[model samples]
Target: DQQVKQNSPSLSVQEGRISILNCDYTNSMFDYFLWYKKYPAEGPTFLISISSIKDKNEDGRFTVFLNKSAKHLSLHIVPSQPGDSAVYFCAASARSGSYQLTFGKGTKLSVIP
Candidate 1:
């Protein structure tokens, strides 16, 4: 079974500062990883992702790093803004053809201005 852990329930960062969210997993079968940002009453929006073959993937202000050896990953947000404050989820999927996603509880980010 696949299990994801986001030990930190929430994070607080100053505006324009950097924010780092951590995630850990117990499943090696996962081949795809993703980060999503969610707001109240709205569905989560995709942020970034990394394939099992890649250790790191970046897009604009977001970067996702995966450590296959330790089954761990982290998402970094540079120059965090107030609008960036939202609940972030770390999700994983396997290439077993099922195409199912397993998600961590989530970490709420608070970017204060």
Candidate 2:
């Protein structure tokens, strides 16, 4: 079973437009959530995170919202730029002393110039 799922394999948006990415999880035990942006042939870098205690988290142009009731989460990028084009991964962990993260396959975002 996929503990985390990113239904959309890819998304395209014009520069300076909002880009929204969705994600879902099956494990209700998961408590900590994170979003990572990655480029080809490189490791993912942490973008933002939200704890189960909160419903939303934001960082500059990036924002993440978590809905525990639906076991769902989403990432929003405001005024997306060509540089924003890359793979975004949603990850989660159960917060039980295990730092191991469960990641979605990934969603590739392409910003057209």
Candidate 3:
């Protein structure tokens, strides 16, 4: 069974608008959540992350929020731009300090100009 799941296969947002991607996890041991953005023919790059202890984390135009009790998390991008279009993967790891991660299927985000 997939521990992490991205229900929406894709999303479309208008430029200068907000883009929100959602992820859900079934593994309760997961204590950290990360978002990765991947462009075509390139490796996934780390975007933003949040710990189970905190409800939210932000950097520049990206923000990640975690709801520990709900086993849900979301990434929000404000003023979405064309460059922001990519496949976003949601990943999780336990507190065991292992580098290994469980990843969701990913949500492809398209920002329309």
**Global local distance difference test of model 3:** 0.95
Residue clash pairs of candidate 3: none
TM-scores for all predictions: 0.96, 0.97, 0.97
Q: What is the alpha-carbon lDDT of model 1 when measured against the actual structure?
A: 0.93
lDDT of 3 by residue, 1-113 (tens): 99999999999999999999999999998988999999999999999888888999999999999988889999999989999999999999997767579999999999999
lDDT of each: 0.93, 0.96, 0.95
Q: Is candidate 1 or 2 superior in lDDT?
A: 2
Per-residue lDDT over 1-113 for candidate 2, one digit per residue giving the tens place of the 0 to 100 score: 99999999999999999999999999988999999999999999999999999999989999999999999999999989999999999999996767689999999999999
Worst 10 residues of 3 by lDDT: 93-102
RMSD of each: 1.1, 0.8, 1.0
Q: How far does residue 72 in candidate 3 sit from its true spot (Å)?
A: 0.3
Q: After superposition, how far is residue 65 of candidate 3 from its true place, in Å?
A: 0.8
Q: State the displacement of the C-alpha of residue 79, model 3, in Å, after optimal TM-score superposition.
A: 0.9
Better of 1 and 3 by lDDT: 3
